[model samples]
Target: MKKIFCFLLILSLSAFGFYPSVSSASEKSQQEVKEAKQYVQKHVPILKNEFKKLSRSSSLEDIESLIEKHFKEYPAPQSLKSNKISVFDAFPEKQHKYEKFSGKSLNLNNLLNDIKTSSTGDVFTFESKDNTVKVLLGEFGDINILEQKSISNPSVSKAKTTKATGIQRQTGIGYGTYGTKLYTLWCEGNFSYNGKTVKVISKDGDYHKHPSGSILTLDPRGLGKERDASIGKYKYKEVFSRLRVEGVLGFKWGEWIYKARTVETYIGSTVDGNIYGGLKSYK
Candidate 1:
């Protein structure tokens, strides 16, 4: 009797379309999937595209050009923009099986030396110029080029100021909801600190976003001025030019953070929506 009752209950649920399904893909659905795959192929040309190999006969210019070409083709996400290439060994040193580029500076001269000499299986890592996406080239002399094409965006690249400066692109991330990119900008400008006007250059990514924010107690004092001043927004143009940043303020413990305080803006550069971190506070 109990089994009969259970069977009836299941039958009732099935009638309401609650049973498991193993439906075949419809013709339209199949076409949509094919189209999606094609779009994905278009989205990331770096991985599918084949790179020309370097040879002993390759010149310094030739090698540089080849690597630059590959970097150009591989699209980087925003976070990985404006960064230098970092070099490392492709594998553990087995009696110095590979000659790694361990030069300290990211200067172009060192890069050329590393590339001109590194043998097969050596690795060179660097962020792409535009998107700052990481490029890990295996076998530097005879290289294997690779870039990011994953679902997540490219990571933030640590790079010095490029000719291109400023921050912009304030838009809504979702329907009926506006989104703002919260971050710090480095600028050399005149600002008022504790009631005195001063000109200074604050570190990058410390342009506090608000007049009031989370506890400064956690943040080490003296990095920049702490304030209750209204930190403002960066216009779209500002992001592209006025704002000097390596990347966006990303996840902190899996949560999005948009905290700010009075920070620095370039002296004499009046930008909308920012509380400049004035001259470094010193004892």
Candidate 2:
């Protein structure tokens, strides 16, 4: 009888172990969804409030000034403790292997490949204020900055029409740090135009500084139809003679929206003063 009882007990325990754990999993999933919703509600409001203020900007400079004032949320992760850049920022390490150049154009595939070959899992530091970006590359990965372009009122045919409007254009910002891979920022009213609406599919870009000011990099591949329709000629612009970006502005002129995508790249400079380069898009 004792032997029989022992066997029965073993069988009961095994059955209990095999029972499904669906109830607990369901509860955990619900909790995660609730937390995510709360996060969206909290951060989305700030973007909305800032956009309302930007609507009042009258000139490209005014719009840029408005964004600069309200765009205080730095894109760098807290682990890196930098405002504009982080240490562990990685770009597409190795994919493209060609070199192309124009009077002022960027080759993204090669750029990403270089980043993959370089950059270790180390942190860096960066700071930007009043048109200057200062970065401290720490003890990992070789950094090469190359082909930087800076322009004050560097007007292009693409941005000329939009510049005439004197309204602030919304731009997204990305930065990197040690513990965090990348940080992203967006303005609420920065999107939505002329009764059209859209959302970001993905982003690929880097953060850098130029002779004139701070600049963010981007990639334009896989941007959807809404954004493709907004393409227009634009010139290089320095809103307050402080911030700088490289790409075609005024891409969103017609019924479409602009959505920018970015991937990781290396952490060095080929030429001094020219930190990084990539494509730019919006949607």
Q: What local lDDT score does residue 123 receive in model 2, on the 0 to 100 scale?
A: 15
Error of 2 at 103 (Å): 31
- Summarize candidate 2's per-residue lDDT along 1-283 as a digit string, tens digits: 0000000000000000011122333343444334333433343344344434443313333433433443245222222132121111221111121111112222223222333443211111111211111111112111111111122221123633321211121222222111121222211111111113222222222233322212223322321111222224421211110112232211110111112222222111111111122222222
- Please report, in order, the local distance difference test score of every candidate based on alpha carbons: 0.21, 0.21
| Poorest 10 consecutive residues by lDDT, candidate 2 | 1-10
Model 2 C-alpha RMSD to native: 25.1
lDDT of 1 by residue, 1-283 (tens): 0000000000000010011112333322444334333432443333223332334333324434654465455433221121111111111232133212222111122222254553322323333222111122222111222121111221222442111112211110000000111222322212222222212222222334321111121232222222223234421111111221111211110001111212112212122222211111111
In candidate 2, position 124 carries an lDDT of 17
Which residue segments of model 2 deviate by more than 4 Å? 1-29, 55-150, 153-172, 175-283
Over all chains combined, what TM-score does candidate 1 have?
0.19
Candidate 2 Cα deviation (angstroms), residue 162: 25
C-alpha lDDT of candidate 2 relative to the true structure: 0.21
